[model samples]
Target: MTRRRTHLRTTPRGTLRAVTGLFLALTLVLTATGCGGDDSSAAASGDGKGTITFGYTADYSGAAALAVAEKQGLWKKTGLEPELQVFTNGPLQVQALRSGDLEFGYLGPGALWLPASGKASIVSVNMLGLADRVIARPDTGIHEPADLKGRKVAVAEGTSGEMILNLALREAGLKPDDVTKVAMDASTVVTAFSSGQVDAAATWYPLIDTIKERVPDLVEVSETKDYYPKLTFPNVFVTRPELARENPELVKKVVGVLKESGDWIAKNPEESEKITADFLGLPADRLTGSTKHVKILPSSELTRLSQDGTVGGWFDRLADIFVEMNKLPEPGKSTDYYLSDLYASAGRTDRT
Candidate 1:
């Protein structure tokens, strides 16, 4: 016998209601056996008695120096035990957050939109200092941004480095099509540049440091500093909405710790550099230059940064750029989709 497909429109509302009731009954039974959980099982307390996993993506191996501040108890000062997970790039880190594997993590500002669109919601709670820099081998004959045209450049695809490259190209009166984009992971870009496989590479610090070491003739053609007043960095801390709602206090504490750590870093640059080097397992000397230039933004200034449309607006601008690049569906309203609630949860209102 063949089974007939039930048409809800053909059935009376009362009949439809009865069928829905039966379906709900079955669903409840399955849920009880497989999905139901108590508060303890669902959320862990972090009184230093239990572990709350804090995820982070830092350049542990390649750009290890850049991530030193984060890896070395910067988050812990806020009284949270963070389990730092290192990845080569932000895209993978964001993917882990969407899969529910991370409670919080750092990702490039551009990658935050997909999660903010309700597929998965995350808030940008903290902004790491701008860490991106663009470098080129002298042999490539590239002296300026305009010189990049027709040259093969290596950058991590779907990352801030790539985004910066695109923006830089436009500023130089060139389009992305004007230059060859060689997609490579950030970790490998340094080696690729050293081997002459790529004409130029755009990446963040310690990779930039490494490239400089191998190619003394290499020159920094452009940097965030040059574009700044107009350019913004790509780093931000993000967390899941559910966790932020349940543990707002803990979130505040974590932010406090990061702020304290930032102060310490500013005051004791040499010691902080050593701690960062130890944490990343890199030779302390190679990281000295990178650390000297590193700047940690203060949490107190976050309010002003948000209010003046610097921090929040940066994300909004990045979303527009993503749309123009066809990386996102369309640019959505920042108020509707961004992590304003997380900021509020942190007791912040003036996110300028």
Candidate 2:
């Protein structure tokens, strides 16, 4: 495969610079306490009827519920005036939450450290790890997991991309070291793989779209859905711990809205996708196949998953991975991050 020259924004040099910034930001989050001012008491005493800011990434599959909720006036129906803000990734949302700039956020496994470090709290789960994939160049002779041995595989070191890569390699009776690993950010990996700098890349959507657009002969390889419940990487909704504790009523209301929105999306996927695309200012068909790639659980399912330890188990497994990668000092219990009582409280109310 010939390398294609393009003016992609995420270059190797830029990513290298980001590595240190990412590390320091994470370090600060872990080491600091009460990063956001003490506003829980003030927010809780109020009637919980005001303009609240909901933060999310530009990812349609992850934040589709928010788009639908806003467009359908669901929040207003419940006496909430919400303002949505889009961020580039989950960590930034965590920062905003800590700084008291945001009330709620939708995030993926990449920001699980927020909860693990007690920097934020996971209020609910959004979806499973369906969007991540391991794709290869057609000319690389790498058609399957077993074919990846000794080949250069591009993956972000500690993100879901690496998790999927390790899982795929294990299934093929191969170790991570069996393949030549190229450490890069998820976005940078997309450009590198498309330009023939790496044989395969473990990344997720919209980035995958970039590779598909630039490289015509992309090979089909493994995806996160293949492992399903065995290896779970969850996209989740989070809020500050103080908010969850001081304002249980508000939490219940938000959860009810999320449930209503998720149910609507499940029943009317076509309309939901269009709403998300339009809200994010993308092509109408940009999220066409997203349903198959991201398993969005209806808000109603949160209570069941919470009661049965399913959601908790997913986070526990994720924490195990973090420990293995030395990102965590030790494994964290699911209760340390997951607020299971929120689901139970939301379920008890008729609002949901």
Candidate 3:
């Protein structure tokens, strides 16, 4: 009988690092793609070995690339043995990172509320979620974006949903208080709409797509614009500064595997959608519809985008909205939280 060796450890952090080196070194033996290639990379913790404990939001498709790559055994292919930590949302993953329960995790604008620790930095933008839309029921007579005025709108407070809704309202010449707002998490936004708990919901993909299928009369109201110019919320992977600097090879492996995942998704869109659908237990169309709302950014682009004012702008816009909502005490600089060097070091030079 053959045995399956997983590159995961449930031990204490110190011992965990030791075992990680052993297994990671062993994993390298399994595949050269798992290690080497980068002529100037090594483990920060001394000898490179063991697996990485990666965290992400399992349900949201924006962060699905990591899960997809993990499912395809690409981590093994790259000589990365990863034990995944799944979270319900970006904030929860951020909490885990803050608590040192996770070395790295995926996040969104929901993290704007967090204070800049200067402890961790965004390694890459996993995907640009042109996410969070204002959807209205046809019965409500909310036709255009302006019709949301005086209507009951469901939004998850202190989240990207509210930010998106607020931005849409501004575009339509309305304010947050103009509409009756109901606070609900992303999960309940759909039910709130289906049960008529609210006239409309400022929600994101998967749910937005689900409401469309479940509520045929659903009126597409508004969506956040590309933040390259608009600061559209992005899903990013954050890692500890020390890990990124010391274990550059590991960082390269992570970013490289993520890029590989993007390529796989491009080549196998249908299979990718089905896997995510089955995982989310939503219809495949819900996943397919999501493509229209998000663009998965490769790590290389993240490397380029992170350098200039673009990503900083996205953070600034988020900080402004969050402060407007009184979600943050003050606006914080996005540059403080993201380290582009790691992505730059890991990015494929051959790609345009």
Candidate 4:
């Protein structure tokens, strides 16, 4: 059965539907493999033939590379019959990949922990996390991070929004418990904050713009970009390890698509944003400042980062933060999940 693509606005306004049955799916796959399946090392196996179901988040900025690939015919140019699916967040995409519902997907910081914890393999690092922000209603008088103390702030736990909020609170010498955290999905954050049900909200774009449009005077109390150097957030590409190991050529082709689309996006920022805006049914002007929020590095730079272990270090640091927050039992082994050789395999080494 083909899963229908979900757009950001299409999900229920105040609900974050959990993708249940992950354990069941994995259990079934493992049982099948043990019973007399092919000699594939991983539970989920793909021949890398036929239509490739690609998953991406449903936002103009997050889907920029994919939208470009689709619009410019890059997928077919690379000999891939692509089926693009839109997910509301990274965990859902991860769930699909584990169940063989998707061959590849783009994930944000919120879901990066899954891959780091051995849920999937990281093939590429595509986008930087700069869109996360905490916006407060002017009447709340939450001008600074410390002002959040005792006030209700809507933030989705286990997402980038929580990371941004925690880092901000740390800088302000405030603890997580200092403020009242109103846990909600990204969609509900907008509704709860706009209705004055919460004092402020922590989220990312294009939802940042969405919230601003509702409360014109919302204050940007904190943003992930402000915590750079000490902290870094990334959006990455992932696939099942079994698929990458068995069909290296297919994985290489997908990497090629990522490099091609990323290179095109880097050289043509304005045109790329326009293409993404049109693809997402959003007005071009709404994406005016969106390009600056995500650092879409060129292919050469990505290769350099992968080779030097810089990319792996990024995940390690993120895992440390999660561990401190008690989200993970321990820090994940970056090398275990991040396949560093894929960049060179895709031939993106030339620093052009």
lDDT score for residue 18 of model 4: 25
Give one digit per residue, the lDDT tens place, for model 4 in 83-111. Answer: 66666667777787898777788887877
Q: Rank the models by TM-score, top first.
A: 2, 4, 3, 1
Best by lDDT: 4
Please, what are the lDDT tens digits per residue for candidate 2 over residues 192-273? 9988999998877656877789997898689877766655778888998888887878877887787778788878877888
Candidate 2 weakest ten by summed lDDT: 1-10
lDDT of 1 by residue, 289-308 (tens): 44433445555565456556
Local distance difference test scores for all models? 0.54, 0.71, 0.62, 0.72
Backbone clash total for model 2 is: 0
Give lDDT for model 3.
0.62
Misplaced by over 4 Å in model 1 are 1-50, 58-96, 108-131, 139-141, 186-188, 191-199, 245-247, 278-287, 324-326, 336-352
Off by over 4 Å in 4: 1-50, 137-143, 146-150, 191-199, 210-218, 278-289, 324-326, 348-352
lDDT of 2: 0.71
Candidate with best TM-score: 2
Clashing pairs in 2: none
Instruction: Estimate TM-scores for all models.
Output: 0.67, 0.80, 0.73, 0.76
Better of 2 and 3 by lDDT: 2
Candidate 3 lands at a TM-score of 0.73
Ranked by lDDT, the better of candidates 1 and 3 is: 3
